[model samples]
Target: MDSNKAKNLEQILESSIKDPKDLTRYLYYRKKLKEEGLSDFISILPLGAAINWARANSVWPLTFGIACCAIEMMAVGASKFDLDRFGSGVFRATPRQTDLMIVAGTVTYKLAPRIKKLYEQMPSPKYVIAMGACASSGGPYTQLGYQVIKGVDKIIPVDVYIPGCPPRPEALIDAVLLLQDKISKTIPQQEAI
Candidate 1:
């Protein structure tokens, strides 16, 4: 199929498959097509933009809370705020399964290396969100605590920085939304060619 036809088909499928189960079936079929040695078929499909859109919408965050801000992060996942609406509610236990790492508290000098290790373990196109002043720039500990790392960005790249001693849950939601926007804007390398 031509790229335009593929794009149209993708749009139709997206519009038709609102249920999660239907989406899963669609993904299965796509995987099957790829496994059948259909490189040309896959290349012509608008899989680049479609895959990025899927990644942006369904960002599975790593469950790695650090401090007080971690509580606020949890609140976002709770009933009142309902982060599931944004498609980022599912928190994965392992770095391998998670695409987003929300560093929701302080990063000390000792923990910096471990954090970097976790970041390295994550797959490509992973994102880091510095979700508090402490994670962003060591909050109250910058001057007082000699052992605290100044910023998480120093250890691994941070995509979004939400500032507060312990930012509100709403701020965490906003940060996730911002990260989604950023991810959606990314052009897959294949599309660049």
Candidate 2:
């Protein structure tokens, strides 16, 4: 069979069978072997389960706030919104101590380097959340502003953008939840080869 057919057959055997039409020549044989009790399916189950768990609850965030929107970010960190519900309440000031950088205000030209440096300081598996329109895309200052850097994403890789002039605390919570969803979709990091 061609490489494409082989790849499809492998996918059929590994994932849901979908239908008889979904199975290619190789998977048809594998199904017959399973009916005859030839091979075990439990062998790779542990790794698959570990991957699912890793994708669910492993998020850390850095509280990197500047300008006015920084206040809203603080409110999210406070009692009402309780960012801990998303497992990201521990607002680490240093980038080295966090995985997600919550860009919570206007990123000025001078501050852009600091933002980039902090992003670089983070370990592997780092993520960023641009909180507010200012942090996301310059907001009211977008019309030819000299000092404003527009968006935090220009300097650092932003994984989620929470849009608003200055997003409410509830909006910030939603952004955190969105970040959680993104976290859930990421491939789990594997052990070193």
Candidate 3:
């Protein structure tokens, strides 16, 4: 069979196989085709854009809570605020499984290295939200305390900074929405011709 026919057959086989690994590989190729602008024939399904939209909406956050702000962070997941509405209420316990890392408390100098390690463990395209004054700038400890790190950004690259000793749940929700907006605007990398 010609290359195009062979590829089509492979896609069909993969789709029907019911194996998670095969499905993942098929999806990867589909994403590549869309990125190269070679998927006009498949325009009926904007798979690439749909994938990006799904990713932006369903951001799974890593669970990392350090101090008082941790309380506020938890509050965001409670029913009253309903962070699930934004598709980010599910907090993953493992760094490898999450795309967002919320630094929700004060970071001490001793813990900075550990936090950095955790951030490094996360996969690429991951985001970090510094979720309180303590996490953003060490709160009352900034410059005055010897043990507290001035900011979480010093340890890991922070994407958003929510200010407040312990920011209201609504503020956290706003930060998440802003992150979703940022995620939605990202352009997929084009494959080299």
Q: Tell me the whole-model lDDT of each prediction, alpha carbons only.
A: 0.84, 0.72, 0.82
Summarize candidate 1's per-residue lDDT along 112-169 as a digit string, tens digits. Answer: 8899999999987799999889989888889999899998999999899998878888
Q: List pairs with backbone clashes in candidate 3.
A: none
Compute each candidate's TM-score over C-alphas: 0.74, 0.71, 0.73
Native-referenced Cα lDDT, model 2: 0.72
Off by over 4 Å in 3: 1-48, 191-193
Instruction: Pick the TM-score winner.
Output: 1
> Worst 10-residue stretch by lDDT in candidate 3?
42-51
Instruction: Please name the candidate that would achieve the greatest lDDT relative to the true structure.
Output: 1
The TM-score of candidate 3 is 0.73
Model 3 residue 92 CA deviation (Å) reads: 0.9
lDDT of 1: 0.84
- The RMSD (Cα, Å) of candidate 2 is 8.3
Candidate 3, residue 72: the lDDT equals 79
